[model samples]
Target: MHAALTFLLLFLMAGTIVPVNRHFRQTPGGIPVFVVSNGVHTDVVVPLREPQTGTDWLEQLQQPQLTARFGSYGYVGFGWGSEQFYLASYGGNFPKPGTVLRALLPGPTLMHVDFYQQAPRPGKRVVALQISRAQYQQLTQLIRASFRPDSTGATVLRNAAGYTPEDFFFRGRGRYHALRTCNDWTNATLRKAGLRAALKAPLAGSVLHQVRRSRFHAAAQ
Candidate 1:
């Protein structure tokens, strides 16, 4: 009985201690960005181009090899997660319990990039926010830093097959575990961009909760 009570308390604490909305100042001349989700996972989507290509940080994705595959998309979505779990779950094979355990423990990770011709339609699983150019640049840096670059200063592509033609996996930095999950990475990226986010979001719900709260606040203002 004591152990059961302790577990219940811990679970409650875990669910609530991470602030779903933290106050942050948006950039004075911010641009629109989107946070998208698919029930279980979340992604950060940024514009694929700008008026001036010279300063477009996402131009790397337009390289011949990638462009030939992803074609022309006005936005790109980025996600990072456990390699085995991601591949298994996305490749039409549900991840085994053992695979999930491995990811929740400690293991390698991957970065998944998906292209979209238009911003995802707003829904319960999607939200958009406005941020300054400086904030956007900071977010881009956070994403680039997450990639494991090869000797040629390019993100190292994973040899494994992707689940879709519009998306591909690349080697990622750091390890994934129950405490530091893909949602945590997304939350951290939002914080780095000076936006409201869960302080330590380990689940997709927590991240999305904060995003929705931010949107509500923006609308109220």
Candidate 2:
């Protein structure tokens, strides 16, 4: 009982301190991008096609298999997490204690991609960010690099039955653990894109809070 209580205290403390520090900066010549959350998970959304660059990269990469899946609006969202944990949790089967424990250790990760027919709306759970075109390109590269591509340079797809048809999972680059979690991936990607984020956000709440703070600060300026 004492050990269980100690662990509970540690978990609570982790939420408060894992992120450690927060910072915000405005990227010059930035374009509009989005940070979206679904209470527990967060995703970064970017354009699927850029008229200025004449690049239909998503269409080119996905080709015949997934090209038809996306709609005219042209946007996609990317997220990363423990494969088992994400599949089980999102499929409505909450992870068992053993599953959670396994995920807390190093484990395989998956990258989730969702196609949106239109730009996602900003609400309580979503915030728009303006970052330079170069930053957006950097963010895209970060996401693409997270996937473990196959011999043909295509991302390996996994079967995630209950998730939306428009979304797919790809084998990811690193292991997922308590310290390097899904939200941490999001925070790291934002930082790679030259955006402001918490130093290390293990929880979606910490990431969303930092994004919201930056959005609010930008608005005030």
| Local accuracy by lDDT, each model | 0.76, 0.75
Each prediction's TM-score against the native? 0.84, 0.82
CA RMSD (A), model 2: 3.8
Off by over 4 Å in 1: 1-21, 25-29, 52-58, 61-63, 159-161, 215-220
| Pairs clashing within candidate 1 | 30-131, 30-132
Segments in model 2 whose C-alpha atoms lie over 4 Å from true places: 1-29, 53-57, 160-162, 215-221
**How far does residue 141 in candidate 2 sit from its true spot (Å)?**
1.0
lDDT of 2 by residue, 1-221 (tens): 99988986577446534443245455544566788888777899888886644546565456456765564657888899998888777655678988889999999988888888888888888888776667677877888899888889877777543377778787888999877888889988987776777666777777777676663345545
TM-score, predicted candidate 2 vs. hidden true structure: 0.82
